[model samples]
Target chain A: MRIGELSRRTGVPVPTIKYYLREGLVPHGERTSPNQARYDEAHVHRVRLVRALTEVGGLSIAAARDVLALMHEPGRGRLGSIGKVHFAVQAARQPHTDEPSESSVARTNDLIEQRGWHVRPTNPARAALAGVLDYFTRLGQPDVLGLLDDYADAAEKLAVAEIDTLGGRDVDHMAEHVVMMTVLGGALLNALRGLAQESAASAKMT
Target chain B: MRIGELSRRTGVPVPTIKYYLREGLVPHGERTSPNQARYDEAHVHRVRLVRALTEVGGLSIAAARDVLALMHEPGRGRLGSIGKVHFAVQAARQPHTDEPSESSVARTNDLIEQRGWHVRPTNPARAALAGVLDYFTRLGQPDVLGLLDDYADAAEKLAVAEIDTLGGRDVDHMAEHVVMMTVLGGALLNALRGLAQESAASAKMT
Candidate 1:
């Protein structure tokens, strides 16, 4: 397919596709002649994935690039690729925490230890969790702290299911699945929560 | 205390506080004289909530203003306020959906009916969920659709607990709590899921 056909099929503009080509987000199509390149089925899939991450998942261009890198990795073993993809996606979503609170850090460590989950203290999620707790502590909202265990329990159930689903995908497709699950999964959870709250609130208040 | 003390206590800058005052996100402090105003403890607390909504919750200034308006409503009953806060907070977070898919909307309505969840199709969350489902439909990833029930169960549990907590707070505090829970709760849930996924991925992959 020519770039225009690719654009028409995928609903992305030709200029945007060209920009993605320059950014290496999508691979260069085979050149049939000067100013004419042919994109294949794989290119269509890649373009769709890139669009999903950027437009719907709200990942930045650089973050989407990092995610795309996972899908293209050729040298690593399956588990190694999984670990790397997970780390990259988590790191991309995590806020930079240069000044983490020691108390929140201690609490996060304790939660990890208490759960006996195989997560490292240096994991970006730990820092992200600690940051939220630190914000709560600063805001004097101690009551909100009590909900952590419940939230973790729910997260664990979903996380386990998410990891289990990854086992069924082909190695080539695993990175995209993980990226989508990690990023869009948050959106899904939030939307579900909104619906549920409406239900609960209606049941209680009405 | 004066504005400077409020700034120092909340760690928000005096100029930002002034901006909040001008924006009416925070109530105007009583003027002591022509050039000086007296701020009390309430100002300090309001500043913290405003910062929390903007910085951690990632709400826009206008969204934050809507949330503050909920907190300031004086005549509405508790249940009415709860309903309003829920609507406003959901409205603020909902992504603009221009051309919603009919199938996804049907699925969202079916899911709501299946669960007997008291959510309207017109609710912002219903649109948000429909949008996500529509994205999945376009991407041809129907497998992700299977996880909705699990996500909803967790959300229902959390939402019930959330509304229960709201029952204990005064009417003014209820709005702040709802906004914080709706917005910051998302940050918290995302962070926790990140940690849980790390744990799950490690256990499975390692």
Candidate 2:
């Protein structure tokens, strides 16, 4: 595929694709000639992933670049698998299924504890959500860190919900059923609470 | 109190306070002399409110100015109450005790019906969280539009577990708990879901 074909498939403009290429965010295409470059499926997928990360996941270009780098890391060993999970879940959502067996949970638990610790806290949001790691330890499940890493990637450091309680950490996937309910739920709760406060303030004034 | 005192109490920077005053985001302090002005507790509170609405609520200065204008609008009756709810909920949050009575619920229902419309879909976020809303509606009661306008808040929107979904509009204070739970719960669920997804995806690829 050429640049136009790639553009047609991904809905990203040719200029924007050039921009991503220039930024080194997108991989270089095969050279067809001195002036032309040949693109492929990898280019298509890469653009889609980039678009989702920046637009849907609401990550900055720099953040999206870092996340892509993390995803592209070697996946041969346990570390690779862990890295893949970190990359995918941070951007794409996993739909729910039935409950897992004790053994599956155990493997997930172990994988989370072992390789997950490699993800250092990049921001206070992840740092705050790191609090949940202790809770997971108590529950005999250490995978919360991996989940938190994934979350930190997707949610962009909503850790201030733990601190000042005024920061915006709205979930990225309002498309997912679980996420939407939570957003609406927050909205409704926030509304009634305000109504109640207003009533109280007026009562006092009266 | 001088602007410095207001700054000390509200923790807003002196420069920002001067900006707010000059921008008319805050009323000009009473001039004590050619260069001196005095503010009061009311000024301090208003500044804090303005900051909360602008910073946390993510409203532009012009937008915040417009919202504050509605807040100061006297004798708008129920519209006045709606503005109060709008501002209060947007400023992070606060807890409340006085639940709406059956009468209040009925009043809201009548007002919503009379408006010949549902909730004005206040936030642009609705398009994102539609999936969660579908999930919630499928489980039981499906009156989100009715309740959304009745609440007209971001934080008040929420998700209840299948077992705990609020059944009726008339339940006093029920909306607050449900909505708060929804936002916080959604955040938690998204975090967990992100984990589940990462775990599942890693297992397959690695």
Candidate 3:
């Protein structure tokens, strides 16, 4: 199929599809001629995944590229399926920390594990920002690092509640919103937490 | 109070407080002498808000600046208190869309009224992301917008369930986690939705 058919089938525009191709998100289609390229079912699958990440997951192209990289790894399983979300959330958690090292992420993970917490390795969110933990740690702010486990523990319940929340919607709408909320809602959670901290200070007076 | 006393109270370092002042996040303290700056309760409040926005909200300085602009307004009781959250959530719906015009947002409210979809503005997340509707309309995409609302409705139910799931931790931790989940959980929600989409597709094939 040409790009138009792929766009019609995927609900993405031809120009945007071309952009994704240029970005190397979707794999190169087999060229039937010097000017024509042919797409297949794999292209269709990749396009849907791309939509899920960009439109629904709210990832930037670069971030989406990282996610696709991990997804392309052999035998990633359900672990790979959920990895990008994890890396995204981790990036959201410590955005200013900048590029962290593998050891720093490992250190934070170790700290969280020491506190008896559970976080999925395959989560793409952690993978994407895998660098920030080290950078932030180098800043010598242990307070944020200390909160990692508690953050994860809090996150685990929210994830379950979020899934449970999906139960009542029409299946089609439910699926898309679930993905959107997962990304957008995660940001809201952080805002709510900040306000709660302020409220706590005010509440102390009472 | 002296800077030392303020530091003792807030557990924030003197240098960090000075940085906050330089950044214009906190108002300057009264200068007692050539070298002395005397702070007060107002400084304390402002500093706390700044720290909360940085650490907990994970907002970039510019993003935090935009949010604080709405917050420091005297009329925050109405606009600042909750409406800001609503607006922020809406503004935040799409990662890459530019800051929208007031008229564009108004146009969205008109669409919601036209659709006659049952929703509430009681809370921002509850009624937030009407900006998403406009984006969808402009893009000629309803399936995605419809899914966003559906996700919100589901999340409302899950919020209640999550509260129940919090089987009596300290109030601060509970509140913190609630906030954390609000943001992080949304990302997880997206992953779930995508997985569901994949499942649905696979089922059709099978």
Highest-scoring model, DockQ: 1
| Model 2: residue A71 alpha-carbon error in angstroms | 2.5
Q: List, residue by residue over B44-74, the lDDT tens digit for candidate 3.
A: 6566555545653345566655665655555
2 versus 3: better DockQ goes to: 3
Interface RMSD of 3: 9.4
Task: Estimate, for each residue in B55-153, the C-alpha lDDT of model 2 and write its tens digit.
Answer: 433356876676566555554334334434344334423221122245434554454355332343342222223322332343222433434443332
For B75-178, candidate 1 gives per-residue lDDT tens digits of 64466776677777777766544355898889888988898898765668887888778767766666777888888888988988877776767765666677
Stronger candidate by TM-score (2 vs 3): 3
lDDT agreement with native, every candidate: 0.79, 0.45, 0.49
Off by over 4 Å in 3: A8-15, A55-58, A77-94, A97-206, B1-63, B78-81, B84-86, B93-206
Instruction: Tell me the spans in candidate 2 whose CA falls farther than 4 Å from its real position.
Output: A75-206, B50-126, B129-206
Q: All models, DockQ values?
A: 0.57, 0.05, 0.07
Error of 1 at B204 (Å): 1.6
DockQ-based CAPRI category assigned to the predicted complex of candidate 1: medium
Tell me what TM-score chain A of model 1 achieves: 0.92
Tens-digit lDDT track for model 3 on A1-206? 99889988766789999999999999988999997899987887678666656753456798777766654554543333333433443353333323446685676456445644344454434433343343223333334444444444454444544555445554434433444444545434422332232233223323
Ranking by DockQ: 1, 3, 2
Candidate 2: which docking quality band?
A: incorrect
Interface root-mean-square deviation for each candidate?
1.9, 14.7, 9.4
Compute the TM-score of each model's chain A versus the native chain A and list the values: 0.92, 0.45, 0.50
**Where does candidate 1 stray beyond 4 Å?**
A2-4, A13-23, A28-37, A95-98, B1-5, B13-24, B27-38, B74-78, B95-98
Candidate 2 residue-pair clash tally: 24
